[model samples]
Target: MHGEPAVLSVTRYHPENPIKMFLLQPLYAPLLFPNTTSDARDHCANERTFLSWLRLAIYMAIVAVAILVNFHLKNQPTPLERRLSHPMGIIFWVLSLACLVTGLAIYMRTVTKYAKRRALVQTGMKTQAVFLVVSAAIIAACALFLAAEVQASRQGHAGAFDVTFVL
Candidate 1:
Protein backbone atom coordinates (compact mmCIF):
# COMPACT_ATOMS: atom_id res chain seq x y z
CA MET A 1 0.00 0.00 0.00
CA HIS A 2 2.91 2.36 0.59
CA GLY A 3 6.33 1.87 -1.08
CA GLU A 4 7.48 -1.15 -3.07
CA PRO A 5 6.93 -4.40 -1.13
CA ALA A 6 9.90 -6.38 0.12
CA VAL A 7 10.52 -9.88 -1.09
CA LEU A 8 9.42 -12.69 1.24
CA SER A 9 10.57 -16.15 0.37
CA VAL A 10 10.14 -19.42 2.29
CA THR A 11 11.85 -22.72 1.71
CA ARG A 12 9.77 -25.47 0.26
CA TYR A 13 8.98 -28.67 2.13
CA HIS A 14 11.57 -31.48 2.24
CA PRO A 15 10.82 -33.13 5.55
CA GLU A 16 12.03 -36.57 6.61
CA ASN A 17 8.50 -37.79 6.39
CA PRO A 18 6.29 -35.53 4.33
CA ILE A 19 3.15 -36.74 6.08
CA LYS A 20 4.29 -36.88 9.70
CA MET A 21 6.39 -33.79 9.10
CA PHE A 22 3.31 -31.62 9.14
CA LEU A 23 2.09 -33.46 12.23
CA LEU A 24 5.26 -32.26 13.97
CA GLN A 25 5.71 -28.77 12.47
CA PRO A 26 4.24 -26.66 15.26
CA LEU A 27 6.74 -28.22 17.61
CA TYR A 28 9.54 -27.68 15.16
CA ALA A 29 8.86 -24.56 13.08
CA PRO A 30 9.13 -21.95 15.79
CA LEU A 31 11.93 -23.89 17.45
CA LEU A 32 13.86 -23.62 14.21
CA PHE A 33 13.14 -19.93 13.90
CA PRO A 34 11.93 -18.24 17.05
CA ASN A 35 11.91 -15.14 14.92
CA THR A 36 10.63 -15.40 11.40
CA THR A 37 13.27 -14.29 8.99
CA SER A 38 14.97 -14.68 5.68
CA ASP A 39 18.03 -13.79 7.67
CA ALA A 40 21.43 -15.17 6.70
CA ARG A 41 23.25 -14.65 9.97
CA ASP A 42 24.40 -17.18 12.54
CA HIS A 43 22.66 -15.23 15.31
CA CYS A 44 19.37 -15.54 13.47
CA ALA A 45 17.04 -18.44 14.18
CA ASN A 46 17.26 -21.56 12.05
CA GLU A 47 15.23 -24.65 11.20
CA ARG A 48 17.50 -27.02 13.10
CA THR A 49 16.25 -25.71 16.44
CA PHE A 50 12.68 -26.43 15.49
CA LEU A 51 13.44 -30.00 14.42
CA SER A 52 15.42 -30.61 17.58
CA TRP A 53 12.39 -29.80 19.70
CA LEU A 54 10.34 -32.22 17.67
CA ARG A 55 13.07 -34.81 18.07
CA LEU A 56 13.05 -34.40 21.81
CA ALA A 57 9.27 -34.42 21.98
CA ILE A 58 9.06 -37.56 19.92
CA TYR A 59 11.78 -39.27 21.91
CA MET A 60 10.18 -38.42 25.22
CA ALA A 61 6.73 -39.47 24.06
CA ILE A 62 7.97 -42.79 22.73
CA VAL A 63 9.83 -43.49 25.95
CA ALA A 64 6.71 -42.64 27.94
CA VAL A 65 4.43 -44.81 25.86
CA ALA A 66 6.90 -47.65 25.92
CA ILE A 67 7.23 -47.53 29.67
CA LEU A 68 3.56 -47.03 30.48
CA VAL A 69 1.91 -49.12 27.84
CA ASN A 70 1.52 -52.81 27.02
CA PHE A 71 0.98 -54.41 30.38
CA HIS A 72 -1.67 -57.19 30.49
CA LEU A 73 -3.23 -55.18 33.33
CA LYS A 74 -5.29 -58.03 34.75
CA ASN A 75 -6.13 -56.54 38.13
CA GLN A 76 -2.78 -54.99 37.61
CA PRO A 77 -1.29 -52.55 40.10
CA THR A 78 -3.85 -49.81 39.32
CA PRO A 79 -1.47 -47.95 36.96
CA LEU A 80 0.89 -46.73 39.70
CA GLU A 81 0.78 -49.28 42.45
CA ARG A 82 -1.50 -51.16 44.87
CA ARG A 83 -2.05 -48.42 47.44
CA LEU A 84 -3.59 -45.56 45.43
CA SER A 85 -2.03 -46.22 42.05
CA HIS A 86 1.24 -44.54 41.20
CA PRO A 87 0.46 -40.91 40.56
CA MET A 88 3.63 -40.42 38.58
CA GLY A 89 2.83 -43.18 36.14
CA ILE A 90 -0.59 -41.73 35.50
CA ILE A 91 0.88 -38.27 35.18
CA PHE A 92 3.55 -39.53 32.79
CA TRP A 93 0.98 -41.13 30.56
CA VAL A 94 -1.05 -37.94 30.52
CA LEU A 95 1.98 -35.82 29.69
CA SER A 96 2.95 -38.19 26.90
CA LEU A 97 -0.53 -37.97 25.45
CA ALA A 98 -0.39 -34.20 25.57
CA CYS A 99 2.93 -34.15 23.78
CA LEU A 100 1.68 -36.35 20.97
CA VAL A 101 -1.50 -34.33 20.53
CA THR A 102 0.23 -30.97 20.73
CA GLY A 103 2.91 -32.03 18.30
CA LEU A 104 0.30 -33.18 15.83
CA ALA A 105 -1.55 -29.89 16.17
CA ILE A 106 1.51 -27.71 15.58
CA TYR A 107 2.68 -29.82 12.69
CA MET A 108 -0.75 -29.55 11.11
CA ARG A 109 -0.70 -25.78 11.43
CA THR A 110 2.50 -25.47 9.44
CA VAL A 111 1.92 -27.97 6.62
CA THR A 112 1.34 -25.42 3.88
CA LYS A 113 4.08 -24.78 1.35
CA TYR A 114 4.71 -21.18 2.29
CA ALA A 115 4.02 -18.89 5.23
CA LYS A 116 4.54 -15.27 4.29
CA ARG A 117 5.44 -12.43 6.57
CA ARG A 118 2.33 -10.29 6.72
CA ALA A 119 4.14 -7.22 7.99
CA LEU A 120 7.58 -6.52 9.43
CA VAL A 121 7.70 -7.32 13.15
CA GLN A 122 4.18 -8.55 12.94
CA THR A 123 2.59 -11.76 14.25
CA GLY A 124 5.14 -14.21 12.87
CA MET A 125 7.96 -13.38 15.25
CA LYS A 126 5.77 -13.09 18.30
CA THR A 127 3.63 -16.07 17.44
CA GLN A 128 6.43 -18.36 16.38
CA ALA A 129 8.50 -17.43 19.42
CA VAL A 130 5.60 -18.31 21.67
CA PHE A 131 5.21 -21.60 19.86
CA LEU A 132 8.88 -22.38 20.30
CA VAL A 133 8.70 -21.70 24.00
CA VAL A 134 5.66 -23.89 24.28
CA SER A 135 7.32 -26.71 22.37
CA ALA A 136 10.40 -26.62 24.58
CA ALA A 137 8.29 -26.50 27.71
CA ILE A 138 6.21 -29.44 26.56
CA ILE A 139 9.31 -31.51 25.98
CA ALA A 140 10.53 -30.71 29.45
CA ALA A 141 7.16 -31.70 30.87
CA CYS A 142 7.31 -35.03 29.06
CA ALA A 143 10.74 -35.68 30.50
CA LEU A 144 9.53 -34.85 34.00
CA PHE A 145 6.59 -37.15 33.59
CA LEU A 146 8.84 -39.98 32.51
CA ALA A 147 11.16 -39.35 35.42
CA ALA A 148 8.33 -39.53 37.92
CA GLU A 149 7.00 -42.72 36.44
CA VAL A 150 10.39 -44.38 36.56
CA GLN A 151 10.92 -43.38 40.17
CA ALA A 152 7.52 -44.66 41.17
CA SER A 153 8.05 -47.96 39.43
CA ARG A 154 11.40 -48.43 41.13
CA GLN A 155 9.86 -47.74 44.52
CA GLY A 156 7.02 -50.12 43.84
CA HIS A 157 9.37 -52.85 42.74
CA ALA A 158 11.60 -52.30 45.76
CA GLY A 159 8.67 -52.46 48.14
CA ALA A 160 7.40 -55.64 46.58
CA PHE A 161 10.81 -57.23 46.67
CA ASP A 162 11.31 -56.34 50.34
CA VAL A 163 7.94 -57.85 51.32
CA THR A 164 8.78 -61.16 49.59
CA PHE A 165 12.25 -61.18 51.15
CA VAL A 166 10.74 -60.80 54.62
CA LEU A 167 8.93 -64.15 54.16
Candidate 2:
Protein backbone atom coordinates (compact mmCIF):
# COMPACT_ATOMS: atom_id res chain seq x y z
CA MET A 1 0.00 0.00 0.00
CA HIS A 2 2.97 2.33 0.48
CA GLY A 3 4.48 2.71 -2.98
CA GLU A 4 2.53 0.30 -5.24
CA PRO A 5 -1.03 0.14 -6.58
CA ALA A 6 -3.39 -2.13 -4.67
CA VAL A 7 -4.12 -4.38 -7.68
CA LEU A 8 -0.46 -5.36 -8.09
CA SER A 9 0.23 -5.47 -4.34
CA VAL A 10 -1.59 -8.80 -4.06
CA THR A 11 -0.22 -10.36 -7.27
CA ARG A 12 2.82 -11.95 -5.64
CA TYR A 13 3.25 -15.72 -6.25
CA HIS A 14 5.05 -18.21 -4.03
CA PRO A 15 7.37 -20.41 -6.07
CA GLU A 16 6.23 -23.48 -4.18
CA ASN A 17 2.53 -22.82 -4.80
CA PRO A 18 2.16 -22.71 -8.58
CA ILE A 19 -1.34 -24.16 -8.53
CA LYS A 20 -2.67 -21.48 -6.18
CA MET A 21 -0.92 -18.79 -8.18
CA PHE A 22 -2.37 -20.13 -11.42
CA LEU A 23 -5.88 -20.11 -10.00
CA LEU A 24 -5.65 -16.74 -8.19
CA GLN A 25 -3.68 -14.66 -10.67
CA PRO A 26 -6.78 -13.48 -12.42
CA LEU A 27 -8.11 -11.80 -9.28
CA TYR A 28 -5.11 -9.46 -9.08
CA ALA A 29 -4.14 -9.13 -12.72
CA PRO A 30 -4.17 -5.57 -14.08
CA LEU A 31 -5.63 -5.01 -17.51
CA LEU A 32 -6.77 -1.99 -19.52
CA PHE A 33 -9.85 -1.65 -17.34
CA PRO A 34 -10.24 -2.64 -13.71
CA ASN A 35 -12.99 -5.14 -14.41
CA THR A 36 -16.34 -5.52 -16.11
CA THR A 37 -18.97 -3.07 -14.85
CA SER A 38 -21.94 -5.43 -14.99
CA ASP A 39 -22.52 -8.05 -12.33
CA ALA A 40 -22.14 -11.77 -13.02
CA ARG A 41 -25.88 -12.41 -13.21
CA ASP A 42 -26.59 -9.66 -15.72
CA HIS A 43 -23.75 -10.73 -17.94
CA CYS A 44 -24.87 -14.36 -17.78
CA ALA A 45 -28.47 -13.48 -18.71
CA ASN A 46 -27.28 -11.33 -21.59
CA GLU A 47 -25.09 -14.18 -22.84
CA ARG A 48 -27.99 -16.61 -22.62
CA THR A 49 -30.23 -14.28 -24.57
CA PHE A 50 -27.53 -13.77 -27.18
CA LEU A 51 -26.97 -17.52 -27.49
CA SER A 52 -30.68 -18.22 -27.86
CA TRP A 53 -30.92 -15.74 -30.70
CA LEU A 54 -27.84 -17.31 -32.27
CA ARG A 55 -29.49 -20.73 -32.10
CA LEU A 56 -32.62 -19.33 -33.72
CA ALA A 57 -30.51 -17.77 -36.47
CA ILE A 58 -28.82 -21.11 -37.10
CA TYR A 59 -32.18 -22.89 -37.22
CA MET A 60 -33.45 -20.33 -39.71
CA ALA A 61 -30.44 -20.95 -41.93
CA ILE A 62 -31.09 -24.70 -41.80
CA VAL A 63 -34.73 -24.19 -42.72
CA ALA A 64 -33.72 -21.89 -45.56
CA VAL A 65 -31.46 -24.58 -46.99
CA ALA A 66 -34.11 -27.23 -46.51
CA ILE A 67 -36.64 -25.16 -48.41
CA LEU A 68 -34.44 -25.12 -51.52
CA VAL A 69 -33.65 -28.81 -51.12
CA ASN A 70 -37.34 -29.67 -50.91
CA PHE A 71 -37.94 -27.91 -54.21
CA HIS A 72 -35.25 -30.01 -55.85
CA LEU A 73 -36.72 -33.22 -54.39
CA LYS A 74 -39.82 -32.69 -56.47
CA ASN A 75 -39.62 -34.54 -59.80
CA GLN A 76 -40.08 -31.38 -61.84
CA PRO A 77 -41.42 -28.15 -60.48
CA THR A 78 -42.82 -25.58 -62.91
CA PRO A 79 -40.61 -22.64 -63.81
CA LEU A 80 -42.75 -20.30 -61.73
CA GLU A 81 -42.50 -22.68 -58.78
CA ARG A 82 -38.69 -22.80 -59.05
CA ARG A 83 -38.48 -19.03 -59.22
CA LEU A 84 -40.73 -18.62 -56.19
CA SER A 85 -38.75 -21.13 -54.19
CA HIS A 86 -35.53 -19.29 -54.93
CA PRO A 87 -36.89 -16.04 -53.48
CA MET A 88 -38.39 -17.78 -50.48
CA GLY A 89 -35.09 -19.45 -49.69
CA ILE A 90 -33.20 -16.21 -50.15
CA ILE A 91 -35.62 -14.31 -47.94
CA PHE A 92 -35.27 -16.89 -45.19
CA TRP A 93 -31.48 -16.63 -45.41
CA VAL A 94 -31.70 -12.86 -45.25
CA LEU A 95 -33.92 -13.14 -42.21
CA SER A 96 -31.34 -15.37 -40.60
CA LEU A 97 -28.64 -12.80 -41.18
CA ALA A 98 -30.90 -10.11 -39.78
CA CYS A 99 -31.57 -12.20 -36.72
CA LEU A 100 -27.83 -12.60 -36.11
CA VAL A 101 -27.18 -8.90 -36.43
CA THR A 102 -30.15 -7.94 -34.28
CA GLY A 103 -29.17 -10.41 -31.58
CA LEU A 104 -25.60 -9.16 -31.39
CA ALA A 105 -26.72 -5.56 -31.37
CA ILE A 106 -29.21 -6.19 -28.62
CA TYR A 107 -26.62 -8.04 -26.55
CA MET A 108 -24.07 -5.24 -26.84
CA ARG A 109 -26.67 -2.57 -26.15
CA THR A 110 -27.99 -4.43 -23.12
CA VAL A 111 -24.49 -4.84 -21.74
CA THR A 112 -23.84 -1.13 -22.06
CA LYS A 113 -27.22 -0.32 -20.56
CA TYR A 114 -26.55 -2.59 -17.62
CA ALA A 115 -23.18 -0.99 -17.06
CA LYS A 116 -24.63 2.52 -16.92
CA ARG A 117 -27.86 1.88 -15.01
CA ARG A 118 -28.01 2.03 -11.24
CA ALA A 119 -31.14 -0.16 -11.15
CA LEU A 120 -32.58 -2.87 -13.37
CA VAL A 121 -35.08 -1.95 -16.05
CA GLN A 122 -37.31 -4.27 -18.06
CA THR A 123 -37.31 -4.15 -21.85
CA GLY A 124 -40.52 -3.95 -23.86
CA MET A 125 -42.16 -7.27 -24.68
CA LYS A 126 -44.14 -5.66 -27.50
CA THR A 127 -41.07 -5.44 -29.67
CA GLN A 128 -40.29 -9.10 -29.05
CA ALA A 129 -43.85 -10.06 -29.89
CA VAL A 130 -43.78 -8.09 -33.10
CA PHE A 131 -40.56 -9.73 -34.17
CA LEU A 132 -41.95 -13.17 -33.45
CA VAL A 133 -45.14 -12.47 -35.34
CA VAL A 134 -43.34 -11.13 -38.38
CA SER A 135 -40.94 -14.07 -38.46
CA ALA A 136 -43.79 -16.56 -38.18
CA ALA A 137 -45.79 -14.76 -40.84
CA ILE A 138 -42.92 -14.94 -43.30
CA ILE A 139 -42.43 -18.63 -42.63
CA ALA A 140 -46.15 -19.34 -42.90
CA ALA A 141 -46.44 -17.46 -46.16
CA CYS A 142 -43.54 -19.41 -47.62
CA ALA A 143 -45.07 -22.68 -46.46
CA LEU A 144 -48.39 -21.83 -48.03
CA PHE A 145 -46.73 -20.92 -51.30
CA LEU A 146 -44.86 -24.20 -51.40
CA ALA A 147 -47.99 -26.11 -50.46
CA ALA A 148 -50.03 -24.52 -53.21
CA GLU A 149 -47.36 -25.27 -55.76
CA VAL A 150 -47.27 -28.91 -54.67
CA GLN A 151 -51.05 -29.16 -54.89
CA ALA A 152 -51.11 -27.67 -58.32
CA SER A 153 -48.30 -29.91 -59.52
CA ARG A 154 -50.06 -32.95 -58.12
CA GLN A 155 -53.36 -32.05 -59.75
CA GLY A 156 -51.66 -31.43 -63.07
CA HIS A 157 -50.00 -34.89 -63.02
CA ALA A 158 -52.72 -36.86 -61.27
CA GLY A 159 -54.45 -38.20 -64.38
CA ALA A 160 -51.38 -38.46 -66.61
CA PHE A 161 -49.32 -40.77 -64.37
CA ASP A 162 -50.63 -44.21 -63.33
CA VAL A 163 -49.23 -46.72 -60.89
CA THR A 164 -50.21 -50.41 -60.58
CA PHE A 165 -49.19 -53.06 -58.04
CA VAL A 166 -48.37 -56.54 -59.34
CA LEU A 167 -47.88 -58.20 -55.96
Candidate 3:
Protein backbone atom coordinates (compact mmCIF):
# COMPACT_ATOMS: atom_id res chain seq x y z
CA MET A 1 0.00 0.00 0.00
CA HIS A 2 1.91 3.03 -1.26
CA GLY A 3 0.27 5.99 0.43
CA GLU A 4 0.81 8.76 2.98
CA PRO A 5 1.93 7.15 6.25
CA ALA A 6 -0.20 9.32 8.47
CA VAL A 7 -3.45 8.89 6.60
CA LEU A 8 -5.70 5.99 7.67
CA SER A 9 -8.64 4.91 5.51
CA VAL A 10 -11.58 4.43 7.90
CA THR A 11 -13.96 3.64 5.03
CA ARG A 12 -12.00 0.55 3.97
CA TYR A 13 -13.60 -1.62 6.67
CA HIS A 14 -17.24 -1.41 7.67
CA PRO A 15 -18.69 -2.54 11.01
CA GLU A 16 -20.35 -5.94 10.70
CA ASN A 17 -23.10 -5.27 13.25
CA PRO A 18 -24.95 -2.55 15.10
CA ILE A 19 -22.95 -3.14 18.28
CA LYS A 20 -19.68 -2.68 16.43
CA MET A 21 -20.98 0.53 14.85
CA PHE A 22 -22.11 1.77 18.30
CA LEU A 23 -18.69 1.07 19.83
CA LEU A 24 -16.73 2.64 16.99
CA GLN A 25 -18.46 6.02 17.42
CA PRO A 26 -17.34 6.38 21.03
CA LEU A 27 -13.79 5.36 20.11
CA TYR A 28 -13.61 8.41 17.83
CA ALA A 29 -15.49 10.77 20.15
CA PRO A 30 -12.28 12.29 21.50
CA LEU A 31 -11.19 13.19 17.97
CA LEU A 32 -14.43 15.11 17.52
CA PHE A 33 -13.71 17.30 20.59
CA PRO A 34 -10.50 18.87 19.39
CA ASN A 35 -11.62 22.40 20.27
CA THR A 36 -13.68 21.63 23.34
CA THR A 37 -13.41 24.29 26.04
CA SER A 38 -12.51 23.32 29.58
CA ASP A 39 -14.33 24.69 32.59
CA ALA A 40 -12.58 27.12 34.95
CA ARG A 41 -10.87 25.57 37.98
CA ASP A 42 -8.11 26.28 40.46
CA HIS A 43 -4.91 26.88 38.49
CA CYS A 44 -2.57 27.30 41.41
CA ALA A 45 0.51 25.07 41.46
CA ASN A 46 -0.49 23.34 44.68
CA GLU A 47 -4.01 22.81 43.38
CA ARG A 48 -2.74 21.25 40.19
CA THR A 49 -0.43 18.95 42.11
CA PHE A 50 -3.28 18.02 44.43
CA LEU A 51 -5.52 17.22 41.47
CA SER A 52 -2.86 15.06 39.89
CA TRP A 53 -2.38 13.26 43.18
CA LEU A 54 -6.11 12.59 43.33
CA ARG A 55 -5.93 11.19 39.84
CA LEU A 56 -3.22 8.87 41.11
CA ALA A 57 -5.46 7.95 44.01
CA ILE A 58 -8.23 7.03 41.58
CA TYR A 59 -5.81 4.89 39.63
CA MET A 60 -4.82 3.08 42.80
CA ALA A 61 -8.47 2.46 43.56
CA ILE A 62 -8.86 0.97 40.10
CA VAL A 63 -5.90 -1.30 40.76
CA ALA A 64 -7.35 -2.43 44.06
CA VAL A 65 -10.66 -3.15 42.39
CA ALA A 66 -8.93 -5.21 39.75
CA ILE A 67 -7.22 -7.26 42.44
CA LEU A 68 -10.49 -7.70 44.30
CA VAL A 69 -12.26 -8.88 41.18
CA ASN A 70 -9.52 -11.38 40.54
CA PHE A 71 -9.75 -12.68 44.07
CA HIS A 72 -13.50 -13.18 43.90
CA LEU A 73 -13.29 -14.84 40.51
CA LYS A 74 -10.94 -17.59 41.64
CA ASN A 75 -12.22 -21.01 40.61
CA GLN A 76 -10.83 -22.87 43.58
CA PRO A 77 -13.05 -24.27 46.31
CA THR A 78 -13.91 -22.17 49.35
CA PRO A 79 -11.55 -23.93 51.77
CA LEU A 80 -8.66 -23.93 49.32
CA GLU A 81 -9.27 -20.36 48.28
CA ARG A 82 -9.59 -19.17 51.84
CA ARG A 83 -6.37 -20.93 52.70
CA LEU A 84 -4.45 -19.54 49.75
CA SER A 85 -5.88 -16.04 49.95
CA HIS A 86 -4.50 -14.68 53.15
CA PRO A 87 -1.61 -12.48 54.28
CA MET A 88 -0.25 -11.80 50.82
CA GLY A 89 -3.48 -10.65 49.20
CA ILE A 90 -4.62 -8.86 52.34
CA ILE A 91 -1.35 -6.98 52.55
CA PHE A 92 -1.56 -5.99 48.89
CA TRP A 93 -5.06 -4.58 49.22
CA VAL A 94 -4.25 -2.86 52.51
CA LEU A 95 -1.17 -1.15 51.14
CA SER A 96 -2.93 -0.04 47.99
CA LEU A 97 -5.93 1.26 49.96
CA ALA A 98 -3.64 3.15 52.31
CA CYS A 99 -1.78 4.77 49.44
CA LEU A 100 -5.00 5.74 47.70
CA VAL A 101 -6.52 7.19 50.86
CA THR A 102 -3.38 9.05 51.86
CA GLY A 103 -2.98 10.50 48.38
CA LEU A 104 -6.61 11.65 48.31
CA ALA A 105 -6.49 13.11 51.83
CA ILE A 106 -3.30 15.01 51.06
CA TYR A 107 -4.81 16.24 47.82
CA MET A 108 -7.84 17.58 49.66
CA ARG A 109 -5.70 19.23 52.33
CA THR A 110 -3.52 20.84 49.67
CA VAL A 111 -6.57 22.17 47.86
CA THR A 112 -7.78 23.79 51.07
CA LYS A 113 -4.36 25.30 51.69
CA TYR A 114 -4.15 26.47 48.09
CA ALA A 115 -7.21 28.66 48.60
CA LYS A 116 -5.23 30.60 51.19
CA ARG A 117 -1.86 30.49 49.39
CA ARG A 118 -3.32 31.54 46.08
CA ALA A 119 -0.28 33.64 45.27
CA LEU A 120 2.22 30.89 45.98
CA VAL A 121 3.58 29.30 42.83
CA GLN A 122 5.59 26.07 42.88
CA THR A 123 5.60 24.30 39.53
CA GLY A 124 7.03 20.81 39.99
CA MET A 125 7.12 19.69 36.40
CA LYS A 126 10.01 17.25 36.63
CA THR A 127 9.10 15.57 39.90
CA GLN A 128 5.42 15.26 39.04
CA ALA A 129 6.13 13.87 35.59
CA VAL A 130 8.59 11.29 36.89
CA PHE A 131 6.32 10.14 39.69
CA LEU A 132 3.37 9.88 37.28
CA VAL A 133 5.31 7.71 34.88
CA VAL A 134 6.64 5.40 37.59
CA SER A 135 3.36 5.01 39.46
CA ALA A 136 1.43 4.39 36.24
CA ALA A 137 3.84 1.58 35.44
CA ILE A 138 3.24 0.07 38.87
CA ILE A 139 -0.51 0.18 38.37
CA ALA A 140 -0.13 -1.38 34.96
CA ALA A 141 1.81 -4.22 36.54
CA CYS A 142 -0.98 -4.85 39.01
CA ALA A 143 -3.52 -4.86 36.17
CA LEU A 144 -1.44 -7.31 34.15
CA PHE A 145 -0.92 -9.65 37.08
CA LEU A 146 -4.61 -9.69 37.91
CA ALA A 147 -5.52 -10.30 34.29
CA ALA A 148 -3.06 -13.16 34.19
CA GLU A 149 -4.66 -14.77 37.22
CA VAL A 150 -8.09 -14.37 35.66
CA GLN A 151 -6.99 -16.01 32.43
CA ALA A 152 -5.32 -18.82 34.34
CA SER A 153 -8.50 -19.50 36.27
CA ARG A 154 -10.50 -19.48 33.05
CA GLN A 155 -8.16 -22.08 31.54
CA GLY A 156 -8.57 -24.31 34.66
CA HIS A 157 -5.12 -23.84 36.05
CA ALA A 158 -4.42 -23.63 39.75
CA GLY A 159 -3.39 -20.13 40.83
CA ALA A 160 0.19 -19.56 41.95
CA PHE A 161 -0.36 -21.26 45.28
CA ASP A 162 2.13 -23.00 47.54
CA VAL A 163 1.34 -26.60 46.67
CA THR A 164 4.88 -27.94 46.61
CA PHE A 165 5.48 -27.45 50.35
CA VAL A 166 2.43 -29.32 51.60
CA LEU A 167 4.58 -31.64 53.74
The runs of at least 3 residues in candidate 3 whose Cα sits more than 4 Å from the true structure, single-residue gaps closed, are 1-43, 71-89, 104-167
Candidate 1, residue 93: how far the Cα is off, in Å: 3.9
> Which numbered prediction scores highest in lDDT against the true structure?
2
lDDT of 2: 0.60
lDDT of 3: 0.44
TM of each candidate vs. truth = 0.31, 0.57, 0.32
Worst 10 residues of 2 by lDDT: 9-18
Measure candidate 3: CA RMSD: 17.0
| Cα lDDT tens digits for candidate 3, 1-167 | 85533322224323444234324543543112111222124434444665665665566556555544444432443343344344334544555555554554444444333333332334345445545655765675556455544554554545443321111
Query: 14-65 in candidate 1: lDDT tens per residue?
Result: 3444354444544444323224554334222223434544665566566445
TM-score of candidate 2 against the unseen true structure: 0.57
Which pairs clash inside model 2?
none
